[model samples]
Target: MTVTAPEMANGIFGGVFNLNYSGDKNRLIWHRHWLVCISCGAYAGVGCFLFAPRGLMYGFVASLFTSCCSIWADYVHIEDPQHLAHLVDRWAAFHFFFVLVCECAYVLHMPIWYLTMTLCLALALFSLSRSSRSRQSWVLLHSAWHVLPMGLLLLPGLIS
Candidate 1:
């Protein structure tokens, strides 16, 4: 059965939530990686109560971006935390491309709020490249990195 947010409402640790995920952040494998993302998409596509003709596009680009970043990291090395260091190396690239897709998807529609949030998310992403020393800071920013895009794509009230 397709999982729903309500079913896992207790949290990620809920029993029903472990369909096929590794649950390891340091190294998120395919099953978990895809489960989390596809679940995210399912939520956005269903729960958002918005017109999401572009949702699949956003999801496709997201997956592609991650794959590309994974390759880039394996081949290259960088020390910078807030720059190409992530794409040249880690998860930051994942967030960047996600925001990139989110940003581009709006070029045609460009609603007032969408444009505003788009800029906000873009700024948040750019700031991610600046690097942070505080682990808490990174945590907050990283969570926002994922939550904001999902919110933009899914939480909007009646997007069309």
Candidate 2:
């Protein structure tokens, strides 16, 4: 019984896309979204390492928090993930975004930070509120929550 990479990945991540999940809707959605969220955090860490080496610690912390949350989801099959996931999500996001804001603190006069914050908040709230209504919407919006900050955070470094 050779467990190949694909098999291993499937075993660990299979629940991510399988929305049906024994006719339980919400459970699988959060699990899947958190997987994407962790990926985003990991990518952000890599981006920090490449561009803003100094922020690698912050990125790592953010990724680790989300990873723990996701791992917990995988560890236990639960009816609802919202309770713990929300707390972990907020903590992880706060650390990531707070570091981002501080890094760009010198550019306080710029509107990009304000705009990014507003958009992130809006997406987070919208995705959370509508999570139960539509899995697709929540997935997309939640993914945006992960990617948007990474893009903005790394853009200036890439451009300059």
Candidate 3:
């Protein structure tokens, strides 16, 4: 079953799009991280197209398309919190698929680095206790999630 916004809070414990931040200072930091993640994601998408092999290119292209949609959803929902849950659910599903594709494509060439990166990603994702409690950590960790997979493109055998 697909989870929605309200249900997402139950799963993530108010992480991701929690707007009840401490103050403008922290919120500003969060916004900066958001921009960083978006920039990294866009860069990764383009890099994947340019660097990935021909057969695997389609997966990255599809991921890039969905990620573009995710970017728009993120910007729009930030302005209006009512749609946040649905957008998160959609993007989260796509992200999982993207991860699977990355795993399949990259693991073929570099197993050790892939394992290490996956471990880091698991740490970042699983450590999200609450966004309210640690907004900086939440944003930073999730940003790592967006950033780490791109490193696969730099792996020796994978880059082409």
Candidate 4:
């Protein structure tokens, strides 16, 4: 019951490759976010490995990066009205690959708990960014999501 690109596009009420102007703009923004997420995830993963030696954290960061890439691909398909379905299909395929990689990394103890927690936070931010209709709201939500987890993670250390 894996969803196909055509199915997703139909569900979203958009043609297989025919995005409206707004859709295109949104897709562009999403792409930029994907780049940022990937970069951050890589850096965080490296940090965990070098400083924390936590496999869960690495896996989590990797997962976040994978999710962002998937979302970016989805938006790209949605924005390209002429071949929307293809983009969606490609994204789905890519997601499957990355998810597998993340799982393997997690099982192998390549990432630690803190990294996993941060990854979850990153995922939440990504969701909020996509869900928000207004730029201001998106930014606010992103900042809040990023800050809250960090504060919570640091609180224990501070209290001790």
Predictions in order: lDDT? 0.41, 0.48, 0.48, 0.44
lDDT of 3: 0.48
Off by over 4 Å in 2: 1-38, 50-52, 55-79, 82-85, 107-132
Q: Is candidate 2 or candidate 4 better by TM-score?
A: 2
Better of 1 and 3 by lDDT: 3
How far residue 101's Cα lies from its native spot in candidate 2, in Å, is 1.0
Tell me the lDDT of model 1 at 62.
Answer: 52
Each model's TM-score?
A: 0.38, 0.51, 0.52, 0.33
User: For residues 59-121, what per-residue lDDT tens digits would candidate 1 score against the true structure?
Assistant: 445545554554333223222223353434235343644454555465434465765675567
TM-score of 1: 0.38
Under the 3 Å rule for N, CA and C atoms, how many clashes does model 2 have?
0
lDDT of 1 at 32: 18
Candidates by lDDT, descending order? 3, 2, 4, 1
Q: Which ten residues in a row have the lowest lDDT in candidate 2?
A: 14-23
lDDT of 4 by residue, 1-160 (tens): 7987666654442232222223443443333243333333332333244224434554455445544443444434434533545355445434533553454345443345654666566556645655667655654554454345435444443465
In candidate 3, list every pair of residues with a backbone clash. 5-85
Instruction: List RMSD in Å for every model shown.
Output: 15.6, 13.5, 6.8, 8.9
Report the C-alpha lDDT of model 2 over 9-84, residue by residue, as the tens digit: 4344332222223324456544444545454554345334532465445545555565455444432333354455
